[model samples]
Target: MSTNAYRGALLGIVAALLLANPAYVGLVMDEPRERSPTGYTATAITPTNASDQRTVVNRVGEEEVLTVAQLEDANEYSPYGPRYRAPERAAESLRAAVESGTARTTGEGVTFTLRRVGANYRYLRTHADDSDAARYHRFDVVRTNGSTVVTTTRVNRSTVAQYLVYKDARLYTALPEYQRETVDEVIAADEYGYRPYNDEFHEVTESVVVKNGTYYVFTTGVHVDDFGPSTKTVVSLLLAALGTLALVTSIGFTLRATRERRDG
Candidate 1:
């Protein structure tokens, strides 16, 4: 009836419209849904010589025999350190050994020689523009008795897409069709989701594979978030709640003013 009453009515109408907006309503009702595969298969093979000593031959025609721990320490936060150089030299030696039809052995009885593949390094260098290009390592497990060969097994490891090879067929087959499809697609393309974060790119997918009874796990260096309420949804719900409260208060004020005028 009065100017204040009319303004209250208008306020109530504006608030009601806001509360009824599809975007606001949708935000309030939004529920979390599955985004990606949450479960992962475990590795099938366990290494028996993890603690064994490894002899590394440097580029200077000198032998630098270091244990696994020492090798790790040499490369810790040091880019061009011994650990980094070791792989390149090891790959060269491996190539030489392979060409000469000889087995490169280290440690005691059963020797396991692990080295980065020279081809992968060259590929990465040639395709420097390709972000999906990854490095690979070659692992050879050899058994010898008094200079006589017994058995040997070789396994290839990819630094990026480790899950490319599923050693256990039954485990892979047990996965749901959708998951299997995703894994297969990632492996086939040799590419994983790379998202930009703070001026840097990060990998979002993780994978694992087992070969020759050895387990290898690798990820895109980014952790995938679980299903939860998104930031936008939370903000929408908050704004909608405020709008509803404003509508209710405006309606109450208008009704109270009308009753007062009638009593006057």
Candidate 2:
């Protein structure tokens, strides 16, 4: 009945409505939601289409989007490509194994050992230790003045009075590293199996670029969703609603107290 009550009710409704939809509030308040750029100078890979096998274009001034096969083709492939471990580290392991005379076995009982007298020698299990001895094979590490090589034989035999040196034969690769937060955000925004199903709804929030021959990373989130709102969306809305209710209740109590004072 009082002006205070009317104003309180109006304020409560307006606040509740604004709190219910943050996106709407941002739009009305002219607040842009674009993310900040990563200081690293590198391009980002962005999807260009809504296809299941979406094409992606490099954000570094490249407008052309490559197909799934095209992207795969662009990726370098090597039989001895860089892995998660360094090749030098693997070589160190080999040296340790040789010095210890006990090769590291992969629980299959297949042993790899190295020995160095005046000459270096390496041995690989042709089969399990419990297998037939006759079927076993031994390898000789031979080093010439020019080059080093490994020769396999059915049995250990005398060489041509040459020097034998163990050559590290393990393949190694450098592990790929990226911005963890960017990678996680992109993966979270993506559909299962990195599909493009969520592309129309979700998008990259921030682009994280790493230069100097390193992996580029980016962050993504669902800005708009045609399907039912995500759990995050629901929780955000609930929090906003609670906050609005609390503020509105406080304002109403304050106004009511003021009205009582004026009437007194």
Candidate 3:
């Protein structure tokens, strides 16, 4: 074979291998898979009158209210306190609650009113902790009936809230301020797990939200793969670029050789 022919063949082989890098990477790559929690379900309590004012009454008589600083100090020494096993964000939330005087009970026999806090919309599988293994959150809805106030709390899989949370986390930085606010408003208004939009990327096997006067519905089902670009992807892209260059060079050599043969 002529020198040009040999060079062209070598280049062609290199091009083919490089061009196939992406396919190879796709096959062997370990993509981050996120499946809906097992046994996803929800439970609800009977509705009460909306007019019934709910207060954080300590059921176990009066107890000493500990400050957030004190709790942290205690955790530093004991490390097995109530906040020890809690996620950092959850612990922070507890601290905030204590500081605000909303939650001030500790020790045995302590009981306090339960209120549904805002949802954590930026929840990601990568950010999951041991607590995520069996996650749940509550939502309360109140209605007024004549001179009575009715309220009900519904408990559902955190996966339900995570759908929107994932979206918000993914798009928060990219969206405009007004758009961000719009998203926040939507989340705030639909606190009872309503409007579980069908995400195109994630496969939502099951999703439903039932909230009305008589009954409340809870839905859960979604799988989110971590889409962040991996090292394999970056390498594949680089290989693709090299492959294109090699292929083009091979074509150039083949064309030159053909011209030489024709001239001879």
Instruction: Choose 1 or 2, whichever is better by TM-score.
Output: 1
Against the true structure, what is each candidate's TM-score? 0.31, 0.23, 0.30
In the range 1-264, model 2's lDDT, one tens digit per residue, is: 566666666677766665767656444444233333221221232222222011111121121111112222222443575322232332333343334432332311111111121132233322222223312224443344433333434432111000110011111122123233433344444332122322231223222233333333332222333355555566567768776886678597668968786887
**Which one wins by lDDT: 2 or 3?**
3
Report, for every candidate in turn, its global Cα lDDT versus the true structure: 0.39, 0.34, 0.38
Clashes of each: 1, 4, 10
The full ranking of all candidates by lDDT, starting with the best, is 1, 3, 2
Q: By the lDDT metric, which is better: model 1 or model 2?
A: 1
Name the candidate that leads on TM-score.
1
Off by over 4 Å in 2: 22-149, 152-250, 253-264
Candidate 3's C-alpha runs over 4 A off are 32-228
lDDT, model 3 = 0.38
By TM-score, the candidates rank as 1, 3, 2
